[model samples]
Target: MTETGAAGASESPRPRDSATVMLLRSVAEPAGSGFEVYLLRRASSMAFAPGAHAFPGGGVDRRDVELAPGWTGPSPQVWAQRLGVDTATARALVCAAVRETFEESGVLLAGPSTRELVADTRDEAWERDRRALLDRSLSLAELLARRGLVLRSDLLCPWSRWITPRGQPRRFDTRFFAAALPAGQQARDVGGEADRAAWYAPAAALSAWKRGELPMLPPTMISLRQLAEYTAVTEVLAAHRDLTPIEPELDRVDGRERVLLPDGTTHPLR
Candidate 1:
């Protein structure tokens, strides 16, 4: 393996339980409003995708899945059973999503409402945990407990799941979720993982990528394409409200990459 490849292989991004939350909002287009998803540009110091924009997410932790005080969202047992892991892991995945979103974007989904958190910026202490969490000195669950916060599963909705190709040096069995950009909280690239952040309409973003303005992994590209199809955030959430987890397989064809869903449909990578 090349040095870069070797480093990527050891990059601690192994297929540990994880989840990504795609915070979206509706913006009025000149003609009508449509869905706009948020993306973050990784800080140049990062090992992977040093300058690429991505959704908020990271590796799951043991405390994330602890059921002692798990939030009511998806069934932990069901998710664990589906992902072929223990119940605890499933909960951790959800917790990771909530935690990652907050730490990376400086947005809190834990409050009663988005506006509330924005109204009261006194909870900046949670920001300290962002560095500590990545540094492995603290877990998200502990952070929330210390802050008297709860994981607002109700704000999150299931979207899709994707696993890295089996032969890749770094792999992730990632769950993607969709959540409304909370009203009061603003998304910022606070965590060092990302240096900058912005929101974009899926179609507009993909168009720019096509023109070489941005680069996206196959899964994220396709996910954005799918997201661009809806005109309203509510419609998109209603459509996926009862999502049946469908993981796609990646294949190389015609000197290009393709995303092959288990259902037999295939889409070309942009």
Candidate 2:
């Protein structure tokens, strides 16, 4: 049987959850199709997906399901039907997606001059406060409440969802979302979970990886390949307007190191 990364010696299982987010943007390039995607290089100290470029996201929090206000995107009922969960859960997941994105990326998705968001984005004061909050295990809900802010769920558009392949020590049932880059807001690596960050044309990023410089999980790789087909963010956003969400199950080949896609195709990992 083909082996995997540290699987033979490890007997314990890894934890997983259905949560994640991808941040995509459009670039002002000379070419017509100019959508560029943002990717973060996780710090080497991370237990999993180390040194891999990924979007800013993580698992849902208990508070995310609480459903606060200033959100005006998809109706909870619409998300409930699509997410295959109760309206409350759907709302929480959406909240989690936005909140996680903020925590991991320092990109705030919120509404009103609730004291905190306004202060955080005004020149990194809020960012400093947020960093402290993250270190203290403070809930995003607490932060919002303390600062009089509302989660702006309207900014996030549901894109795609992916589940990690079975047999992976760490698995994730990730949901991808796209947001237009906010005006006057630029992204930085924030130097904790992510050591570095960059923006690249989707097609260019794929080509670079083909040349073997970048690392990508199956879902991220496929998403970039698909995003490469479009030239602008408008096209990509338009494609998902129907809000058709895809949930793919990853199947691992028995006694060998290979994974199968729904198309009955297989790929091997290094």
If scored against the real structure, what TM-score would every candidate get? 0.78, 0.81
User: lDDT values of the candidates?
Assistant: 0.68, 0.66
User: Highest TM-score, which number?
Assistant: 2
RMSD of each: 5.2, 4.4
Indicate which candidate wins on lDDT: 1
lDDT of 1 by residue, 156-191 (tens): 777777776444555678888888877766676675
lDDT of 1 at 181: 79
- C-alpha RMSD in Å of predicted model 1 compared with the true structure: 5.2
lDDT of candidate 2 over 145-170, digit per residue (tens): 66767776656667776666544666
Q: Which runs in model 1 stand beyond 4 Å of their true positions? A: 1-14, 66-86, 112-123, 241-270
Model 1's TM-score against the true structure: 0.78
Scored by lDDT, model 2 comes in at: 0.66
